[model samples]
Target chain A: MKSLDIWNRTYSRAFLDDLPHRWQRRAFLRATVKTATVIALAPLVSSLPGCSDQRSTSPPLSQAPWPTLAAVQEILLPHDAFGPGAADIRATPYLHALLQTSDFDPEERQFILDGAHRLDDICQEQHQRAFLMLDPALRDPLLRDLAESRVGDRWLGALLTYILEAMLGDPVYGGNPNGIGWRWLEHTPGFPRPSKGLFHA
Target chain B: MTDHYDVCIIGSGAGGGPVALTLAQAGYRVLVLEKGPWLKTSDYFKDEIACCRRSTYTPNLRDERHVIEEREGKNWKAQSTYDSGWDFWNGNVVGGSTNFMSGFFFRLKPQDFQLRSEFGPIKNANVADWPISYSQLEPYYTQVETEVGISGRVVAHPFAEPRSTAEFPYPPTAEHLLSRVFDHACEQLKLHAIPTPRAVLSRPVDERRACEYAGYCGSYGCATGAKGSARVALLDRAIKTGQCEIRPHAQVQRLISDDSGRVTAAEYVDTVNNIQRVRAKIFVVACQAVETARLLLLSTGPKHPQGLGNRYQQVGKNLIFSAGGSGRGEFEYADFSTDQAQALKQIGPFVNRSLQEWYFINEKQLGGKRKGGTIDFLLRHPNPISRAVGLRRDDNDELIWGQALKQRLKNEFTRAQYLDYEVFCDWLPTDDCFVSLDSAVKDKWGKPVAKIRLNSHPQDVIIGTYLSNQAKTVLTAMGAKNISGSASTSPPQNLMAGGCRFGTDPKSSVLDSDCRMHNATNLFVTDGSFMPTGGSVPFTWTIYANAFRVAEIIKHQL
Candidate 1:
């Protein structure tokens, strides 16, 4: 069973907005977004040469629902002017690696993969096309509508949770490469970071 | 072959550390049976996934789980921790939860020993006076400061307990710029803001290093051996004495007692799942509060049919957790100058401010004179994933994606510095809240697990709310925005105490004044379980002090 109690507590207190702020200087926001995107995506471009070896060891990205899952992730965190998008952070690959791990919860992994297939089915029913075939403009509205449902909401929440992990987790976990996420947010991680081991030794 | 020792300590946390150290140093053979792994300082890191997301420091719920009985309307419903994911096990490693604690150390006041006498008992609360007084534990508290490495600047506050020493052994840690703002606000509000004491080292003490000012102090293990965890401070020194033997991954099953009710040996399952027995002159049970009670309840002998110390059915009664809530206030960088903004964004320095102004409430609303609580102010933890996860939902509780989500993340992360406060009040012991063995559920070892019934006294919430509001007033004075906090009945799993209270009367309490089991002369419980009334503070400092005091008594007996 899903831990509804833990989820509820986390969600309810998420947006306490304990310190309200006025959003002034849209130009400053645009400049920071452009700078962050460049700095965050630099490592991905540099690491492109090593992609073939990683792809040979791992499952191919062309796996049926993986393409659909990637599409959903892109919509959730699109390549906007604000910062590096889901694709820039390699969120799909990080998630794929996480699900493939032995320690990862099998039930949760199944839930995520099943949700991607369900999203495609919903798209086919509503728009007479698979989720990937749907127009880019039409995708956000459908996702918003899907958020209103129980299963859809949890599915989206799960995806968003993994997305955050990919964005902010340590670089050793196959995400946040070159400390891109940390650089973007000016986050200073604690010292003696996990380097030798995959998780705890 | 069974190994014999002068003293055998079960569990190697705060309660067991001092006993092992003191006994071993005094030329006695001390054996510490720890259920967890012996993780060294080099093994610790600040990985958020390993420390927080995964059960790296604790056992998986699938193997060992708890059954929590929470109130539902008039009836109570019990749920396994495996299903709820509400892990009851703190740190299952060598040092126990002390390895993960933020190290906020506070001493109990003199009145806390005699809560019933200081203020008349509340209705339905099992309030009682302690057999020992603050004066008795004062020197040991000082001992913990010197021995366990406490660092703070002591100032005269409204509720400052009588101390044997004028100052802490070590100087206060490096402070954040926000502490100045907190002090100024307290000065303006006519409130005394004391420097919060920490068990972390401010300077290098022998082999142990000083605090590196790592932002991940709580939840994450100390990589530098700066935090005064049981392993780093006490157990390590005990090992150096060559008289202490710490056997990790030795899960104690039960204590074998003779017909005379004296514990002869401890039967335990080793790492290889082989049952091993260790005979000792005296046995000390310090498996935390819940497990201590569960161990006692499971060990039913010929003389003790009910349990070891459950003759009067007081072994697993009157469990307590620290009652309080946490709140945060944000300081926007836009409202400050460039230098001020830069200072606000600086990480790593500690925010060591706390308020005890309302430690004693004197108002008509709370019946004129009553107990209040402590408000500790700190910087919001710098865990990026936790912060990003919190920003996933919008104001309407709907999932926000795309640009909206990105904007929210940026604003929440880089735009402001958040100052948070945690309130600590007494979780008044009640008859409803206690620990028992669950018959239906069992651990991986097939032993019955602890079933805890959680029920807080109504006055606890009242006092908590009063303290929370007072904390918000401080935040407001500090020019903070959108300050919010509330007290709830849900217990903080880490700060647990009681269940095997120590007192003068054997019929009413499990342990005697010296913390020795009244019925079983050779058995003693040294954890927070001996606390009859947990003060309005974290129990680590008091537990360490009392254990040191108990160690002296055990030395005499040996």
Candidate 2:
């Protein structure tokens, strides 16, 4: 239960500086995969460490570590004023687990994992560090290139698009942690709570 | 008497929630009795195993499943009755079914209100004209939409009933992952893929806000209160006013009768701790269709030995279950991707109704394997569960199954959208497909459970087949591959109708046009049980409308 603001300050661009372009993309994909995997495996790995009610557990990051993967997720769905980022809500591991389970099909698993591999290869050939380690300048360009590519295989752009969507999507699927998504949308989290003026204590 | 009120309403779901609020607002002392507990949105979770398998959010049905037997073939057939499909099917909470509904709202067509005259009398069907016309109920329908804060567009359809200009209180919710595909496919097919009208608020209305893109809106309860359940809309206001008193855990067993054959009060064993009686000058039975009919039958006295409203034996007669069907398709296009499609704002509602083309589909034949029926309303944006189970691919190249299936399903698992169009033909009431009391068995409270002996006639089968084929054709036009359809073996008794049907003829029907029970001078029935003929649309909106209408009638009387 780290303060969300503390987590945010820890994730500034300075932490991502000096890493090469290709490596940064690879790292991002890795984090996305890890997140899905953790979500899928949350039920089985309940006793890993932190268990805040079965349904409310953020993904287990320690026992099942996806270093490159976790960092990349931070970059994409960062915990900011925008909403709950995947990693901020600690959803990366849950997502990683989700990928392996029946929740997702084999093609989706392959797309996520294979797409990460392809991204990493490109980053390695160009810049030096994995995607998350790269400077924001280098990392941003790589993401743009992937998104704009219509070449031998359009894996980078497509995977980035999918991951970003999931990150910004619903809290019902491990994203938008807490009422964070609602706050970002300028709406209240739904249910049982009374309106701002009516019936609120 | 433990407590007394000017008007006492039973069951706090669709009918009771609205009526209680309206009457209380109008300054009448109203008391509402609810059998289920009141739950908030936070109580719900997003686990299919718990919600679907464990039956976490539905009525406990262990006894009824064993006791109620249909005379199947020669021997009595016992259907394994469980909760329909989590909270989405049947919720036993204080908000009633609204707590777990997709919120589709369609008005009963003009013809639906007068089926006996328009369609002529079909053999064996208890077809009759409604005491009131659709035009008479239009104002109340408008009031319901406004109060519930519906988000819809009044699309133009030739056969659609006319009404004053109205716009949905909020905009339609954004299509879900699967809905995007269905939208694109519908655009390609040139057929109307209307936004299913939902009771949910699209923008903040009153105290609630728009949808949060939570994929669990359909079956599982919405903790956000964005969906227009009674807890969110009516019950809260009614309770806050303090003019209405809600007595939870009061499961009414029988309607007490005076010496004059009028319902004097209701008897019940207090589900909480104490068994007590509460008398009211007026009584409204807002219990759902099955329970309403069963209560009427259980309270048999000398004046009405058959039941409360069974002078003509029509109390539990003409049971109409929703005639339901669906179609699924797989498409190849990146544009249909969930990410890109969210930008294309505005999904249309099945708001426009055409009697010529979009009329209820019927399967004329019965007693065997036949295609299902159709009502209008294409439901897009189904969450994961519906896509996994209901929208599976078939054995065709375009359909795409097996190993490639694994890849495609995986890729689109979160992105692929399943477009669904459900047709609900208002089942014409038949004397045979009705609810009765199981004399041999009882429930947890030792009251007779609702014994449903239902078998749809050949006409119902005709309606089913017609609707199912029409659904297939609509999907075919949309390039839907691996199209399939099947009718349920059980009769349309599932949709529910008539324990207290409304008509002018006291000898034939139970209640009057205002929903007042014929025999009981002060007792009124306001649920789906009072429906003369089931409308060819989802019944919730109409049910709310009728409740409002009756509330107005009660208001005038008060």
Candidate 3:
């Protein structure tokens, strides 16, 4: 999975257009398609990458290869004077967990995995190190190149979706701790906000 | 229990729900075959990923997809559903799309009933008059407003159609602070900024609770069962009567007809993949517009070759999808006075407002007299994940990431509040837009899926563009900064109607004035399929009203 070859063709722009335009299709998809996936993604941050206790019995992320994806997401949407960033909300691990779930399409999972590898390959060639090891100063060039390419746009769009989940999605799903994202933006969530629990998949 | 029923209805949304509730209450054994499972109140929650990002409530495009055909110059190129861009909207759950609808209810004016008579032939457009008048359906419309639980204050507006009832059953709830801003702006423009009528409930009725204002309206199902969805308002009541049985996960394959040309049975694949058959005295086909036509075309028997009621070749012709454009305007809270700023910060899920000033077509829009559309003013969806994803810019042509992209997103989220605008214009059916069985593509069930060919008439775009400009003007009057949005050529695939058009003539239409098939005496179509012309607004209310009207006729005949 070096490139987009493994990404499911069903999610392609051509396929999305087979219905209507992208933004509109996505608007309706909220109620029609993603309900179960929303509950499935919900869980406490699962004891970040390495620091875990004996009581922690969640899946291990030792070989998950999430750092490059994390670095890219952080570089793409870092926290500044504008509210919280990917680092504060744990966007990378939230996305990693989402990709591992049954709710995500198998092909979409392959696409994300392949995109991370390709991004790392480009980072290594430019900065003389793997993507995660690259200096914060040098990460922009790789993102610039990826953003400029057609293949990289899908990856960017998908990453942005998860980043949004981290910022605005229900906190039970391992992001937006303590309603910080909602308070930052002042978005009045509809009543009956969920408690911490996963809906049956 | 008898395997036979008094009525066998396929699909269970606005089209079938009302009729099922009415007939079952009237002591008729009604069997409703829904393609999806029966979701409970506990089943629905604020799960954005499951309800929006994945195919949990709709047909899995990977297994079943519609083939869309695009016409360029001289060729019609086909695109398979296998692609991600393929429009895969439309609910497969028991309540159908109504379970997730925004519930913006607007009645079709009297002029909409006679499009062909009002506006003479306009080149290639296939606009026509509805077989029934708005007056005929007005009483049923009132019934839905009360029984189905519509909540809004009816005001006297120039662009509004005539009302049969004196007032709505319930007063509007969830009126946001932004609605007053729109009222002020519209007062400046002298446009009728009517309180947009929503099908969602404002107060508790019987066992259901009032809207919780969860901000999760639209895409997610109502946990409180206050949205007036079929499952909440109609099916639940019908179940208590014990006469209505909803057979979930039963996909009706075809309508089995008798030698006399009337549909006698519904053949379907049950949940366990067994081919189950149900006999009925009367059959109603309300599987939505596209699937309704597809099912009829797929039922090729010895007596009906082209398909059921396709002998006149009018079964799948003249399909119309509503065309429209959308625009969003942003306003900063810092610019407003302290009182206004406080109100702006507290905006909630509801901001029901729309201008019907252009509901009737005028000459200024088309350079000549013609039919026009409506403009709906709304608040941006509360789903923050979609809002952030919406701000991401990586369409390949331009790329912004890292700090620059992050800053842009933050500004969009926190800087200023946004208002959404949508123009709903009529899609005049032409020879270009219709549904047929695809030869090459097949669904997971091994059946030929619908092959849709869509191309909107040029006037549809012109009227929608004029209405969109009017929407921008409202934003400008309301002191919105960077206000922009225009009409597009894209048709809203979900708001589909026509195909199995109803008319008095057997040669020109598929159904009679009562929505009964012209050829089959006992078969009826109660969905949007019988609509010859979908008016300037959404068709759900009209579909529900018409279904209620048809239910009366069915009862009379029985």
- On TM-score, the candidate that comes out on top is 1
Q: What does candidate 2 score in Cα RMSD to the true structure? A: 14.8
* Over 4 Å off, model 3: A1-59, A79-83, A123-128, A194-198, B394-397
Clash totals in order: 0, 69, 36
TM-score of 2: 0.67
Better of 1 and 3 by DockQ: 3
- In terms of lDDT, the poorest run of 10 residues in model 3 chain A is A23-32
List the candidates ranked by lDDT, beginning with the highest: 1, 3, 2
**Steric clash pairs (candidate 1):** none
Predictions' DockQ, in order: 0.24, 0.02, 0.36
TM-scores for chain B, listed for all candidates? 0.99, 0.85, 0.97
Point out the higher-scoring one by lDDT: 2 or 3. 3
TM-score of chain A of 3: 0.71
TM-score attained by model 1 = 0.92
Query: Listing every candidate in turn, what is its Cα RMSD in Å to the true structure after a full C-alpha superposition?
Result: 7.6, 14.8, 3.9
Give the per-residue lDDT digits (tens) of candidate 2, residues B1-558.
867788988888888988899999988889888776666665554433234433333444443332345676787764334322111125566787788777767777777777777767777777788989888888888888778767766655445567776666666765543444454655565544555567877777666766665555566676667778877788888887879888766778887887788777777767554677788888999878888888888888767788887888778777677754544544333545455444322232222221224463233444343222234434344333323322223442122222333334345443333445555664556766677777666776777777776666665546656666766665565555556664443543324556577889988888888899887778888888788777666688888889989988988876
Restricting to chain A, the TM-score for each candidate equals 0.70, 0.52, 0.71
- DockQ of model 1 vs. true complex: 0.24
Better of 2 and 3 by TM-score: 3
lDDT for each of the candidates? 0.84, 0.58, 0.77
What's the true lDDT of residue A168 in model 2?
Answer: 32
